[model samples]
Target: MSGQLVRSLLIALATALVAVPLGYFVAPWLGWGVFCLGLGLQLLFHFRNFARLDRWSRHPVVDASLEGEGEWDGVFGRLYRHEKELRQQIAQREQEIAMLIAAGQALTDGVVLLDLEHHILFCNRTAEAQLGLKIEVDRGQSIVNLVRQPEFARYLSDNDFSRPLSLRPERYRERVYAIHVIPYAGSRRLMQIKDVTQEDRLDQTRRDFVANVSHELRTPLTVLAGFLETLQEIELDTEERQRYLQMMSDQAGRMQSIVQDLLTLSSIESAPPPEDEVVDMSRLLDKLRRDAEALSGGRHTVELEIDGKADLLGAEPELVSAFGNLVTNAIRYTPPGGRVRILWNRTPLGAEFAVEDTGPGIDAKHIPRLTERFYRVDRGRSRDSGGTGLGLAIVKHSLGRHQAQLDIRSEVGKGSRFAARFPLHRVIAQG
Candidate 1:
């Protein structure tokens, strides 16, 4: 027997001994009934205490009374410690959930959570702004009802969480976005939105550039091959041979110009941005104007105007190439005796450079794609003028690297103005 049971038996025996002696003495005076009643009550109390102890043994409580059992107490202690550790782990998990919620709110990308019924469960601040949604009103509302796009409705209705659907949310004008849907947990889902407009534009630009380069090269190669074959096959006088040689040289020069421009564009793009170096706009314009005049054979009048009080800070060679292309295009397209004017000025917004020409101006429809590689308003005119069709493309890239903006304003019959505006930070005080 255990110590508790032994103690209980001893207490019971002592009580019985005292009760028997008292009953023996009192039996004659008070009657046998009274003595028997007292003894029965005492026995009942002892049995009840024993029953309580048996119940406690089956369902043990870890308390002071349970200590000092040697082996048994060690097992009880381990059970108590394991329960405590489990509770602590649960508390840590709750804390992690709170932190994740805080982080999701701080993200710039739009995020939304939905339930199996296709109802909105939660939305982040970015989603509210980007999608024009209010979480308070939209929560528990059908996702299909809120997002009216037919494609998105179908995507949500489908149970597949492996692939996400892309969408351009109508809320943001002139922008595109990609969306991803993932099954969250136990009948829940997560949606993520990312901006991809700039990336898409860049992809299209690269494809067009590759095609243009191939076409430009092929034309020159074909001309050279055909001219060489004719020279080999036919016998001609000295004058005719000289003419053929001159034509070949012209074709070769055109090819050389295209290759050089390609190299310059590639070099500009591959290298890191140039360090800021102060450049005098007046001096650069004077040199460029004289060069343009010479290139035009003095057929077109070249005029220079400087109104800006600020100099420029960037790579001089890149500026030269960008500005020279604009001026050269003017000279090439303008009729003989027509005027080309280059203007430089500083506005409150930034420094502006404009090249205005009396050439046959571009139509309104072609203005958007004028800077595209090999995209010509008049291909025959461009070819006759010996244009590589990469000049405007070079200007566009150079301006982008300098964090500048290019604006073209033109009318069909009137002259055209091609202007570039640089940020105020890039403009320095004239010395």
Candidate 2:
């Protein structure tokens, strides 16, 4: 039995023992008075202990150590230990919750928690930045009313979280995000959001590339087919037949050039880094000048200046391709009688190969995307110049293999300058 129960029994027993003997020895009324007195004393002791326990329950900080019997002190000690354990458990849970919130805030993807009524219960920093949500201001507010996206509101109401919803951020037009909702604890929901703008742009670019290639091939193929039909169906004069056949051959050559450039680009993309070798840039530029002159056909002036560094360490063929592309691009773009200058020299950082032209220059806006594959600032003019629109792109990828960078400067009504910069590690200057 508990100490309190044993003490109560002893008090009752002692009271009865003293009261009964006194009742027999003296007057019965006097014995009854003793019994009442003992009973009152025992009841007072029990009430004081119970009142102390009640006060401690109401105000836990208050000391419950009773001044009375040993049993009451034991009761207060057990209660105090139990209360301490409960408080420690509560503190541990609070710490775990704080850690979870910190981790969620650090995530790149946005996270949002909702109540059964679709109210904003909690959200991370990413959600606030991505979705324009304010946690403190939007708390307890219905999510649909705050986000203001019709698609998202419909998604929430539909209760179908099998598929994710794609949305454009309110502040940015080019950016795209994917929002997904999942059912969670007790009718609450979790919304996860991811940024997929780059992926979306890449997919669109891929589609455009396929379409452009098809259109480019289809034009020449259609002309070749028509010429073949003409050659087979009718017998013409010798001179007339020669002219038609020559035109057909020219068309075939254009198609062949496009195919060759595509193949070159594919090779550059798939091949590993080139084996280290010395490149006699002086010799390479000399040959490139001849080729540019032959291509220009005396229509444009071509010049070369290799006064600085001449030799370098790199893959010879890739470097030749990169330099040749820049030279050819200058020749192709310059109008008749325009001047084209090719220069190779050493700078503080490394070596630079530049192609400057006197033809009509490109706009500042178009300069940034000049090296993108199949990108053209003037589609009609590029086609007329017999360009496949892959020259700059080829230069960029080939130079990348050599750890070089291409810088472009252009102003409309003036001319453009294209430069390839080789870092110090790759430049081996020959005296």
Candidate 3:
């Protein structure tokens, strides 16, 4: 038995023994009455202790010092210690839950937790943005209803979570997401979402790059191969033979140009940023004018205008190649009587090296992609003009190395202007 119970029994036994003997010594009725009085007093004492216990129970505090008197102290002390341990365990569990939530929120990928019925239980901030969900509002809503994609609905129904689902959400049509569902904690599911728009675009671009390169190189190789077979198999006059040789040479040169341009672009992109080297803007402008005039071959009127005396700070060779491409493009596109003006001017933002041409201008839609490799507004016309289609792309990368930007402003039938604007840090004012 407990110590409190044993003590109470002994106290009761002692009370009965003392009361009965004393009462019997005086009178028999008195002995019985004394026993009854002792019993009643004992009952009253027990009731008073019970009332204190009840009060403690109504507003119990887990404190070691908060206890009862006599035998009840042990009972109150044990209860307080047990409650303290229980509270500590509860706080520990709460802390673990908080840490788990924090870790989920720190992830870049979206995460959603769902019950067996696919009801949304928890979703992190990334999930909220990617899937357009409000945790507070959508907490018990079904995932199928919230996503509302037919394919996604089908994927869930099929229970084939073996492969991740790749889809563009209707709300975010431009972005692509890869979704994976893992069945965990019995029947509940964990949904993970990763944004793969850039990866997808890069993959597509790689495919297009390979296809375009093959197409461009194949045409010239085929022409050269056909003519070589002709020269070997057929007998021809000296004049015809010379003409055929010239055509073969032209094809060879075209292939060489394309290869050279590709190599230049690859080098520019792969190489580290060029060391800061002073470039003479005045001299560069003069060289551009000469190169443009030579490339023009009296076809267009080439003019040079220098309104800025600021020298640029970058690799001169890269600057030459970039600025030269702009001039060459202007001269090649402008008509025989038209004007091609190469201007080096100071703007509010920075120094601008612009090539303004009275050529057939570009459409607005085509201007944005003009700097992409092998991108041409008109493929036939570009090929006829003997362009490798990588000039603007080269210009773009080269300018990027110098902290510059290529700005193309064009309107159909109104001619075009291509400008390379250098940052203020790159411009050195001549004294």
Model 1 C-alpha lDDT per residue in residues 155-255, reported as the tens digit of each score:
77776657756677767657777788887677888888777779878988889888888887888788889889988999889999899889889889998
Question: Which candidate leads the pack in TM-score?
Answer: 3
Report lDDT (Cα) of residue 131, candidate 2.
82
Please name the candidate that would achieve the greatest lDDT relative to the true structure. 3
Q: How far is each candidate from the true structure, as Cα RMSD in Å?
A: 7.1, 3.3, 2.6
Question: Which residue pairs does candidate 1 place in steric collision?
Answer: none
For residue 346, give model 2's deviation from the true position in Å: 2.9
**Which ten-residue region of model 1 has the weakest summed lDDT?**
62-71
Ranking by TM-score: 3, 2, 1
Worst 10 residues of 3 by lDDT: 60-69
lDDT of 3 at 262: 93
lDDT of 2 by residue, 304-353 (tens): 88767657788888888888898888999999999999998898889899
Model 3 clash pairs are: none
lDDT of 2: 0.87
